[model samples]
Target: MLKHILISVISNDKPGVVEAIAETVSDNGGNWLESSLSQLAGKFAGVIRVSVSPEQQEQLQSALSQLIEHGIWIKTEHIDADSAPKSDTTNAYIHALGPDRSGIVRELSRALAQHKINMAYLETALTSMPYSGDPLFDATGQLELPEGVDIPQLHDILDEIANNLALDLSLSETPFE
Candidate 1:
């Protein structure tokens, strides 16, 4: 039987950091599956999904723990079972952008929470506009709306928030692959 797990790593950024973590997983008979990694504020942060034989599960966990001595902090959660995508929900893609400022995420996330919307993943970044050189805030994420929530309802909520925050927001139902 195969065991699935999610591992989150945070450490000072440096060369060979990913290689070291990957090598440890390989040595422990773990198969790297999916990952989202990035360098932020001079640190390497990422979440990796991996699978291993049930027999090697403990060994893999132990090996991952030992990485802390090398300045790599890791937290692992063993998944009990694979989660099938939900059918009673509306999945959509969201893009939000505006001038870089504080409280954008808090406001938007708060609004989503108030409406019981589930955010699958959200990535935000600060970037400069090409010609203007002004700092801009960009966010992209996947949202799962409850069955009763329609696209128009979601758009209305997002539109209100965007107007208040002076953001350009877009939301579209995700076409199934």
Candidate 2:
């Protein structure tokens, strides 16, 4: 039997961070399943899913823990496939941009919650606008809507938010690649 685990890690931004994680997994007879990683504010952070034989779970976890000595801190959670969240029936990619300001994420999340929509993943950043050098907010989200919420209705909600916040927003189906 294989034990599935989710690991989240954070460390100072540097090369070989990924290599360290990959090597640790490979050395433990684990299969590296899927991961999403990023660098921000000079820090490296990500979540990874891996699978290893039940017998190797403890040894593997201990080995991963040893990485803290090298400045990489990790947290692990063991999970089962059957216990995963229910799959969403509809998914869309949403992008938003406007002048940088507070409460943008809060408003967007509140709207989604009122409509019972789920945000699967979201990335947001503050950036500088070209020519003007104005502070701009950029955001992208992967949203999951359940069976009863139609896309057009969701669009209307987002449209209202954009108008109120002076933002440019767009939604589209996830691209195939």
Candidate 3:
């Protein structure tokens, strides 16, 4: 039998970091399934999902610890698919565009919180043009809505907030798979 493990790794940014981790898993006969890795503030951080046979679990942990001793911190957790929660919820994707300013995230998140929406992912980036003195910030967020909620009411609330914040906001319903 094979078991799934979710691993999170964090360490100083350097060459061959990913290679070293991948080699450790490959040497242990583990298959890497999914990962999201990025460099933030000069540090390398990542979350990876891998599968290994039950018999190889202990050896894999030992190998991971060895890597940690060499300066990379690793955390591993066993994921039981059967115990995962099921959701019959839907969601809407909200995209907002406006100049960089304070109170944008606060206002948007506050409104969503009041409606009991779950924010799954959020990304914001600020860009400045050479000729323009002001910077523009683009913000995108994915929000999960409860089943049987009125979307029109939600849109009205969002629009009201956006207008007050002087941002252009767009919302669309997306089915949760």
Tens-digit per-residue lDDT, 61-159, candidate 1: 999999999999999999855664646877888888899888999988998888888888898889998899999999999988877875677788889
Model 2: per-residue Cα lDDT over 3-120, one tens digit each: 9999999999999999999999999988999999999999999999999999999988999999999999999999894565776568888899999888899999999989888898
- Clashes per candidate (backbone, < 3 Å): 0, 0, 0
Off by over 4 Å in 2: 175-177
Model 2: how far residue 87 lies from native, Å: 3.8
Model 2 superposed RMSD (Cα): 1.8
Q: Which pairs clash in the backbone of model 2?
A: none
Q: Tell me the lDDT of model 2 at 152.
A: 85
Q: Top TM-score: which candidate number?
A: 2
> Model 3: how far is 89 from its true place, Å?
2.0
Off by over 4 Å in 3: 82-84, 174-177
1 or 2, greater by lDDT? 2
Using TM-score, rank the candidates from best to worst: 2, 1, 3
Error of 3 at 113 (Å): 3.3
lDDT of 3 by residue, 1-177 (tens): 788888899999999889988999999978998888988889999999889999998899789878977678999999974544477677678888877789889999998888878887777778773578688777887888877777899889988988887788888775222
